[model samples]
Target chain A: MIKKMKIWQLPLMVICLVGFQLYSDVVLAHGERAQQAGIRMRTMYWWDVDVQPTTVKVGDIVTITGKFMPSSFWPEHLASSEVASFMNIGVPGPAFLRMHSYVNGTPMVRSTRFFRGKEYHFKVILKARQTGVPCASCCQC
Target chain B: MGYTDSVKDSDNQSHEDTSRSDVSQDSAISTPEQQRRIFRAFDWMLVPVASILLGGIVVFLVALTVGDWDYWQDWRDRRWWPLVTPVSLMVAPAVFTYFFWKYFRLPIAATSIMMGYMIAAWVSRYANFHLFADFPMAFVSPSNFIGMAIILDSVILLTRSFYLQGFIGAFLFGVVIYPLNWPAAAAFHTPLVWDGYIVTAADLMGFMYIRTAMPEYVRIIEESTLRTFGEAVTPLTAFFAGFLTILNYYLWVWIGSKLAVSRWATKLI
Candidate 1:
């Protein structure tokens, strides 16, 4: 009876593995998710994020537009945007090349300050260079 | 009892004295050939070990001082990168140069240390940045310093004067970095039009590689006023760097001399 059960265990494990591969969804997370919840919630509030033409062939341009407001309740422990801050896109690898990025129509080629409780609109144009399902998100540095 | 006993005592003392002298002679004696072989073995062991330790120190010093500038292609801008990299890099070479020249009269210290640094830097760039972090080799490649090192060493060899090395070699060390590295960097500086915006290839590469550190936070210090210098900004930056390097070189050489002080101990207490 012990020998019979051992022979069946391998097949059962194989079936479970195959079932998981077939049924499981691919869950992905951005680097920002690793930050503390308090910091993520209190630092900046992003809204109205829109990525146009989500699917594109190689060399096709994709536009990402968004607005964010520095939270009035921004944690005092964290650095203020006035010190050193930059708006950038978070993407997977070199899948897309950023052609232009602007904040309120001002070219953001260098680090700029963001005032607390002030709303800022941003636009980024990216040219796809590789084939991938890339989730584009805004990031601050 | 008196005469024969006295003669025997004298013989014993003489024999003891001769044996002591022979023991001392055996301990002190070594042929020139044997001495050379011993030194050769020491050199074989010491050279690699010292190179690695000094090279590691230089790499750490550079990383702590101006790491960001040297790490990425996009950060290698017109103003700060050219000025900061050479100045920061001069520390180890300056220290080692003084040490080697004062002790051995060998002018190859700068070249040897620089060579070790290059090896260590390349290995780190490959292992840490490229392979581990998944950054491209082109984006993370280190700048070439061997050429500048050769020039510095040559100046020391030719002039054999610390003042000349400070004035000529140190200046050349700073001024030559940009020009020496220009060939590798020029391609990355090529202009390209994307979405009606002018961007360099380096900038484009920086954008393509998504780093945790954003592009906007890059500490490139090319100012608008300096941009007016147009094609001459690089040369202007290089000259200023050379001046700073001269001052820095002398300071480090002084420090090196103090560190290289040797004293013999006559008394254990």
Candidate 2:
């Protein structure tokens, strides 16, 4: 018997599948790739986020320096700063050993109070581990 | 009859005949045995392909989008942790239901869905770690997903009712994840010292594990001091999580049913 579906429909399905894979977004990183411009304008703006040696060898010590200024009109939906806030950075895991982190040129170990409209410069020194080193770091506050 | 009327009548008949022939040429009704063989072949081809496709897309999107890795302590510390955390994760179970209700049906649907979902999650997480970022497998692991699947499936199997499964099964499904993961969570709850912050083991693990490049706002969760429930005394979060799961179960089941009634099923004949 003649198979009409196999003749035309099957080829279309295959082409569609192949096309989907080919055009699929190739994300070089994880998390939302782009942040809404309004969100950035309304919320915290960190203009200078500088990390030296974009690429580092295993066990090589690296430093992260950035200026963070929180948005004055903070959205009510977000977490309230009434609770304990910390000066933290986002990292992959223990893979990149954090030797130390300093905020406002002071040695900091724990969660600290973050002030809105304050341009506080923070620095973190991390050693790249053999297996993995979090190439990214973000504030948990 | 007049000459013009007879000619028009013949033209109309010929047109109807041509249309009927076209329909017959497109597809033919098969014998019962042939239909059975066709269905079996379709099953063999569609099952693996569909599961892999759906599972891969859903799991990867969840992981890439809302996945909280390198910091379970901070994650669990949130107030709406239970309600919001499972929002995206619910996609897998929701879609997996289609295969269960449509083909596998009752009694066996739970087990089939569980295995299929597990394989799908395993493949996606493994690929994410190796191909995209060199994060640890434990970060995006789906081991906990197994319990939820069984609970969702068993609700129907044990109760033999859809509404009951929605209310009870989904509740059990959400509540089960915490206890099942308690042993893992317990390890993190252990008191420890890290950078003199007086943190837990889980916090230390976060300080230790390295995610290549993650953002700050992404780690946002409701971390209220009131959320701390006297060392799991009330299981408030778990219950809340279960409540949310019930909502998710209904939503997912509805979606599954809609997908089950596809245009393809009409073509089977």
Candidate 3:
């Protein structure tokens, strides 16, 4: 005979599994997405994310434009202005595929910072890094 | 709870009546002691699993904080950016907690809770520095934090009182915070005069070339030292840092001992 799980145990296990997966997803998102759980240090301008052709296919030329606004009390732990402004575009993962980033129009292969209220916009080719997901950070948001 | 109950109510009146009565009687009976014992047993049994899960979470948090998000998709990323620190620092101390609690009749619930902070800090670093913004520290270098955690755990392992552990661990925590982080942190702050321009390694790597804002012409280094170790200042700093680490170690051992002795600990099988 199959050992039956108690009525409470079944729900508890499901909760644990979902909790574990959510924890994994946050850890995978890295920076702003990861840290917001504790100290919500940065306030983002999601309303300002301008995406040309919000829908795109693999290998489509899409432009993603957005601005990140840090709070007035940006931590001094952040040493440099260049190190404070950062931008990243990627799908949720198994694999975090970063498509493009820029620091005041300069190509940012590494993470960089922007001024507290400054805006950043970028245009790039979205070569569907992976299949089955629609290409838009906002759509997912 | 089952479809059979519905069928029995419709087709088997006698069986349905008996089953309903059994359910009502079982619900009415008091079994709090049995439930408590069962939960206590489960909690003790799950300790190792919980410890492993805590360790894994720490690894995941470290990777997010330390590893470059741009390189997460890149195949050539290092195998152990985040995991190494947690495995050594966290797991060792957790295992120490488990052993202390089980073998030496100590309770380490507090130490386990502190691991949550370590995980949170790791995740926050990843979110704030490594992922969201650009700070020029390589491989997230959270390994520096392992000593702090080890010290915290060691205090719990060595002490018999929470008051003493809390007082000493907190002090040692503050004392060793700068030292443990100094080496890697120093790399980011090290002043380098590159091509007549005063810059850090972060500035050397294609960071901003802000010549106009700071006016590079005005800044000048009158004295220069290229020796592997900078004058006596380097040695003095190292000696002080090492001294702090040893002091933290002593404090953590005490904390670990205190945690291991709580009356709330479940019996080990």
Candidate 4:
């Protein structure tokens, strides 16, 4: 094949090869980057995701922990802002599963309670979703 | 041979050969001046086109995710906040200026600023309809606020002054932003029906974030009512928004100018 190729086609061949390599690198990088930043899923209020492997394959469990404290505010305020004394635990928008979030060893569920300054903990199991880089600032998987 | 005969004339033939060789030599030697000229030309022309296109892209994405253009046929009642379209679109100009200043080191003045907003709005509108709404650009109409942003920007750019940029840019911003948003947003601008009592659209949009509740019903105003509010709200909206946007634009543009004059931050490395 090398002997059969035209001289003029050599640059084109090199360009095509380089393009494919760059694309694969981008795809691989995003997943690896996401795993490293997966700790972002832990909320400042409830849980803090501590340890995660540098690379995680599908069906692998990632531990997520949350420390809960005694309720210091009215329950009404906890449920709805209009009546509540507690800051909602669901403040940083919605939660993501293994990729975005794993709360107390489970996925994030919808609820409005802030164990005001209390200590409660949970673990998250990592589950594979789509392929891409997770934003450490916002979403991580 | 006639053409060749002229070239072969004795003294002239030598001169022609000399020039031809010069041309070949020159082709091998690329001048730095020529490269600079090419870069400068690209700076003036290509940069602006890219900037405008960037502006359009921002608007397009917002239109997609915010408007939920996919299910337009239903036009079911949705709370205004679900739309979360920024209360004003003036942020576009300021944001565009910031990006241009940060990345391109180019001063975005007057019409260019407005152009940014207009492009952003157009793109967002296109994106909203096509991506989310599942409609084409033609079917998804844009607001005259686009025209207003461009016009305001044009006037400021032409004047090349700050006060006019701030006052006029913001005024137009305040005036047109919401109105431009109203047509598509009207569907979602229903009054709050919280706890089973009907409340004004203003209440839900301003203070509450009822993320989970199902949309109840759309409020259908009669033709007369629509016309009445259209006449009344349009000018009022513009005036109020224009004031704020103008103040904001002034601050951002000044910041942009300052950034332009200041030296870039240096690192020890």
Winner by DockQ: 2
TM-score of predicted structure 3: 0.33
lDDT of 3 by residue, B60-172 (tens): 55455433322221111112222222222333344354445446455554355446545655666677656554333363324345466656556766885445544564345
Write model 4 residue lDDT over B159-263, tens digit each, in one string: 655576566655655565555556765644454444343434432331122111211112221210111123354555456556666676766666665655435
DockQ of each: 0.11, 0.19, 0.03, 0.02
Query: lDDT tens string, model 4, A12-81?
Result: 8999999988776332211233234332223223334465654555455444455644434423311222
lDDT digits (tens) for residues B1-269 of candidate 2: 23345455545654688875465456552233444566668878976776566656655665565555322343454344454545555656655655565555634444444566568767666786544665565544554566776777777777767788878877877676666766656655667655555655645545555444332332333231222222553377678877887787778778777777656688786
- Tell me how candidate 3 scores on lDDT: 0.44
For model 4, what is the error of residue B35's alpha carbon versus the real structure, in angstroms, after optimal superposition? 7.8
Q: What value does DockQ give for candidate 4?
A: 0.02
Worst 10 residues of 2 chain B by lDDT: B221-230
Q: Tell how far residue B85 is off in model 2, in angstroms.
A: 4.6
| Top-down DockQ ranking | 2, 1, 3, 4
Root mean square deviation (Cα) for candidate 1: 17.9
Q: Candidate 3: where are CA atoms >4 Å away? A: A1-61, A65-83, A90-96, A103-105, A111-121, A133-141, B1-248, B262-269
Q: Estimate candidate 4's alpha-carbon lDDT, on a 0 to 1 scale.
A: 0.43
Clashing pairs in 1: none
- lDDT against the true structure, per candidate, is 0.77, 0.59, 0.44, 0.43
Q: For residues A43-127, write the lDDT of model 3, one tens digit per residue.
A: 4444466767765555555566665555555554433344433334544321222344454566553334556666556533233
Q: Is the docking of candidate 1 incorrect, acceptable, medium or high quality?
A: incorrect
Model number with the top TM-score: 1
DockQ for the candidate 3 complex? 0.03
lDDT of 2: 0.59
